[model samples]
Target: MKTTGKVWKYGDDVNTDVIFPGKYTYTIKDRAEMAKVALEDLDPEFTKSAKAGDIIVGGKNWGCGSSREQAVSCLKERGIGAIIAKGFARIYYRNCLNEGLPIIVSSEAVDAIEAGEEVTVDFDAGQIVTKKGTFPFPPYPEFVRGLIEDGGLIPHVKKSLGLS
Candidate 1:
C-alpha cells in the first residue's frame, strides 16, 4: 500500500482530547461531524485546511493521553492518509490499528519532515520518501495489513466470517 500527500506537522505529547476534544464527545455521534472538529483544539485551521489525503507527522509521544478511539476515527473520517510519529502511546497505537488508521513510528521522518512538504509512504517497503531523504521503518505484518485494508478489526472479522 502507498500513500502520498502534503504533511501536517505536530509537536510531541499530542493527546486524544486535542485530536478530538471532549467538548463534543457526547454531542457528536456522526463520523463526518466529528471530523469537522478534528484537531481544532490543537490547530484551529486543521479541519479547514487539511485535505483528504494529507499526512500527519508528529514528534515523540504522539497520542499520549486518553484512549478515546474518536481520536483515530476523526482523523480517518477526515480522510487522513497516515500518521507518522516519533513514538506513540501504547493504547493509542493499538487504537489506530484497530480502527484501520495507518500509523508509523519513525523519529527520523518526524524530525525531518516539515509541514506542507509532500511525502510518500510505501507500506509494502516500510519506507517514507521526501525531498530530505528516504527513511525506513518496519513493515506491518500481513494480518494487521489485512485488517487495515479491510477497514479495521470489525470489518476484517466480518469478512473472515463471510458476513461481508
Candidate 2:
C-alpha cells in the first residue's frame, strides 16, 4: 500500500545522467550520499523533497544511460514508491526490478497526468488510484510481483525460489 504525492513530470529519453549523475558516480560510497545527487539534471532537490509514495512520470527511455545499481538505490533511498514511464531501457528496467523498485510502462500514464496529485497503488489489484481516476496497468505475474514485494530480485529469489 503506497500513497502518492505531488506528481513529478519529466520528458522522454530521460537517461542515466538524469537518474544517476556522473558527478556522483565516484561518490557512490553510500546510498544516502548517492541519492542526494540523484536526478541532478532534472531536480537537484528531488532527493530532498521526495516523500514516500511519490510517483515519477516520464516519457520513453526513462532510464537510457548506464546500468549503475546506485541509480535504483538513490530512488529507493529517496522514498520513491514507483515510477511510471512510457518505456525504460532494458538494463535499467531490470536493475529497478532487481532492486525492488516498482516501475510501470504506460504511455497513457505519462501523457495524461499532471504534477501534484495523490495516487494510491494497490498491488494486489494492480491499479493506481489518482484524484482523477483509477488507471490500470498491464498485469504483472504473481511471481514477478512477489519478487518486487520481497524487496528485489536477490531477496525474492532467495525466498521464493529458495536459492542461495
Candidate 3:
C-alpha cells in the first residue's frame, strides 16, 4: 500500500470528453468499458495498459471540461494511484475530491518529473519525492483528505458516523 507508483505525463486542457466519450457514456455499463475510452485522444492504451498505483502527471489546466463524475470514476477504475498536475480545472478538482483521489497541483514537481519515474506521495504532509528532489505542494483540506483516505466523500461520511 505504501509502494511508489509509475508516472505517466500529459499536457494541458485534457477535457472530459477525452476521458469519457459522450457516446460510450450512455451505455452505463461497467467501469472497465468506460476506462477503455479514457484519455483516448492522448493515449488509447491508457485504460488497457495502466496498472494499479500507476501515477498520472500532467501540465497546467489538467482535467478541464465537463463536470462528469465519471471522469474521476474511470481513473479510479483504471487503478490510477494519484495525479500530480501543474493546475486543475475547478469542477474536475472538486470531482476528484469527492472521489477521494489525491490530485495535487505542483508545477515544480510536474516539470521535473517524467513518465515511468518512481516517486513517493505524502498526502498528509503534502510532500512529493522524486529522483532529483523533494517538494511540498498544497494539501487537501483536513476533512477532504480524510474523505480521500476513506475512498470518497460519500463512503467516508457513511463510515465516519457508522451509517454504512
lDDT of each: 0.91, 0.79, 0.81
| Candidate 2, residue 150: how far the Cα is off, in Å | 2.0
lDDT of 3 by residue, 1-164 (tens): 34368888888888888877767667857877666667776787775688888889988888888888888888887778788998999999989988877788889999999787999887666789999799887766788767777888889879978998
Compared with the true structure, model 1 gives a TM-score of 0.95
Better of 1 and 2 by TM-score: 1
Listing every candidate in turn, what is its Cα RMSD in Å to the true structure after a full C-alpha superposition?
1.2, 2.0, 1.9
Who is ahead in lDDT, 1 or 3? 1
Kindly list the per-residue Cα lDDT of model 1 for residues 40-153, writing each as its tens digit.
889988878899989999988888888788899999999999999999999988889899999999988888898999999998888999889999998788888888889899
Evaluate model 2: give its TM-score: 0.88
Best-performing candidate as measured by lDDT: 1
lDDT for 57 in candidate 3 is: 93
Q: What does candidate 2's lDDT look like per residue over 114-164, in tens digits?
A: 777666666667777776677888767777777777888888778766774
TM-score of each: 0.95, 0.88, 0.89
**Clashing residue pairs in candidate 2, if any?**
6-116, 7-116
